[model samples]
Target: MHPHDKGKDRLRKFVARSEPAHPKLPLVHSTDAYTFTDALEDGNLEPRDCDVFIGEALIYTFYGRPSYRPNMNESATSLDHYLPVCLILKLSFAQDLKRIFPFDTGAFANDYYSTFMHRRMGLGDFALEADLDTPGRVITTFFGSARNYLHAAPDTKTQFDPAQFEARSYAALIDAKNSNAMDSRGSGIEIQIADPISISNWVEAAVVPSTFVQSETGDALRRLNIEILPYNVHSRMKPNEYMSTVTDACLTYYAQKGML
Candidate 1:
């Protein structure tokens, strides 16, 4: 097989591992902007998801899939717009939910508005004011999981023993990315994720150093290009803490394999 083809095969495996459950994954933070706009049109007082439709046109719709209860440590203030479309494009993209979330159909929504503009786009001020080091537990989780996957051997078979552990991590990352309350993109501006230098730092610092990651790291990056997108974006967190956590997680990995 061609070396590049070999690389593609590796990444497809890596992403497939941490992509989160595609089935009706627990929905959270998501709101249908279209439905919310209808409320605005008729002058209803009910709460809107993204402070989005207050204007004549809906800017964006935010959505989130709640994970680990409502108040996890990394969770930001409840009112913050976390579930910007960058996290889950499909979930945020609503032509019209044509349906309310399962069991709670209090409202229905569509993606028409959100597709063109994220709720964060409406809050241009808030996005600018957000901090740089916000815990952002969910996005961190996703970034870490992706980092972890990149750390895995390209040929490593998916193991079953670490299922729930893996789930929590992936869910955390996806959750943070989707949750509007804790994320910065809540302001509805087109945010840039890791700059070229920051992304280069990730590969050079962590991914390249992993025992399992080798030439495939750079290739997978080129193929997936998650670094460029700011929405579902995650960053290389605390160098010290990340080192400790990955060390512990790696120990667990080896232990599960009876390798050590």
Candidate 2:
């Protein structure tokens, strides 16, 4: 059988098996824009099992099917824009993800964190003002091994683990007043996802919106090239403690796997 056929067969079988238990469950067909868009339009809101493939390479396994819930979009507040709302993946494929993608994690750390230096600043301003052209003022941190992936200075505080990663927003400066000056992109804050995939994969991971990744230099960006976040993902967060809570969650997953 052809490769595409095999993938579809796998997806169909997965969905067939999942739907018997979860009638509302939606198994994503492929990590492509059209596939996700069509699923959403078809009201396939609850994603069950999905395949995440970059080009022809399957790098990671994203699990944690949302326990049957309604599409509660009516009461969603601005906090939802910045919270870790997506289903977490085990990232059992972390090594493969980095190997196949081959990015300069160091450059991202230097540009997003060290160059701006906001670790002690405490998340900076809740609201930031900036665009694709400006440096984001807010700081968002993830719990996975961003430092290790980027090969920056070792975290001296502790040994590197795939379970611990951190990244801040390098797109703008955080300031409520200045936030009003920037265009209304998502929540006007940089999103910090801890253990990005280890937590939960976004419902719209494959069909990422254009606004989520606004880069000018044409040099590849981690968000667009690697993470493949949904467009406007910044606007869908749960608020302050969400980051920490998710970090702990990712750590727990790793701990269970004996990787931490």
Candidate 3:
């Protein structure tokens, strides 16, 4: 069969079938049915706050080539709604800072600092110019999704409608900072998401879960330790302006050493 036709058939099947409920997922409600804490209890604000503050949080989220919208309920906000397979890598600030921040402040400021702070609300001295070469235990939600073979909605623009497809998971940890470990394998995973039809079934068969344990390297990524400020929730500022506000807030808070 032609690849395009094959993908369409697979997409049709996915739409027709029923996906088993993820046990960890609670029943979601509409926006009118929720309040501020409702979003918090659902694990959006805290992790996101950590992502912003941690200076080195890296995201590995999935999206269709055109556009991919994940499963959403009424309780979801544009800020928090995400597909099931999204992963954010959180590192240990205390233990791994030395190794992870192998690049000096000069390299960071010139090459990465302002750009990351401006875009993703964090800083990573790690070499992303090619592949992730820094070593640290990255705790992320993907650890759970990978184990479950989570489902993600494909792009609607590609003639694939509201069908969900399997999403595989993989993780690699290189113990050496700035090592050419990934040069051989070419960044480990092939992430060129194209037509969901061709790869939907492939995702189901490619579930390779990252293991978690409380080793001396520190505990596996389980919980994030940051909280979103009130302003981050209801800010009228534009994206850049809002980030500036957040950056100022972060700077002041750090300068105060938690006094604020």
**Which candidate leads in TM-score?**
2
Evaluated against the true structure, the overall lDDT of model 2 is 0.25
Using all chains and alpha carbons, the TM-scores for the candidates as numbered come to 0.17, 0.24, 0.21
lDDT of 2 by residue, 1-260 (tens): 21222211221122122111111111111222233333334433222322321133221222122211122223444532323333333223231121110111222223333333345322222212212111111111211132221111122333323321222222222111233222112112121111223212333223233443453311232433333434343454423323333333433443454543
Whichever of 1 and 3 has more lDDT, that candidate is 1
Write candidate 3's Cα lDDT for 1-260 as tens digits: 21111111232233224332222221011111122123334433121211222333221222111011123222333342221221211211111111112122222233322322223222221222121221111111122221121212112122223322211101122112254322212111111111111111111111011111232111212233222222233323222223233223423433344312
* Error of model 1, residue 89, in angstroms: 22
lDDT of 2 at 68: 13
Best by lDDT: 2
What TM value does model 3 have?
Answer: 0.21
lDDT of each: 0.24, 0.25, 0.21
TM-score of 2: 0.24
Candidate 2 regions off by >4 Å? Answer: 1-82, 90-240
- Candidate 1, 24-79: lDDT as tens digits: 11112222223322332443213323322232221221222211111123333222
Model 1: how large is the Cα RMSD against the reference?
A: 22.6
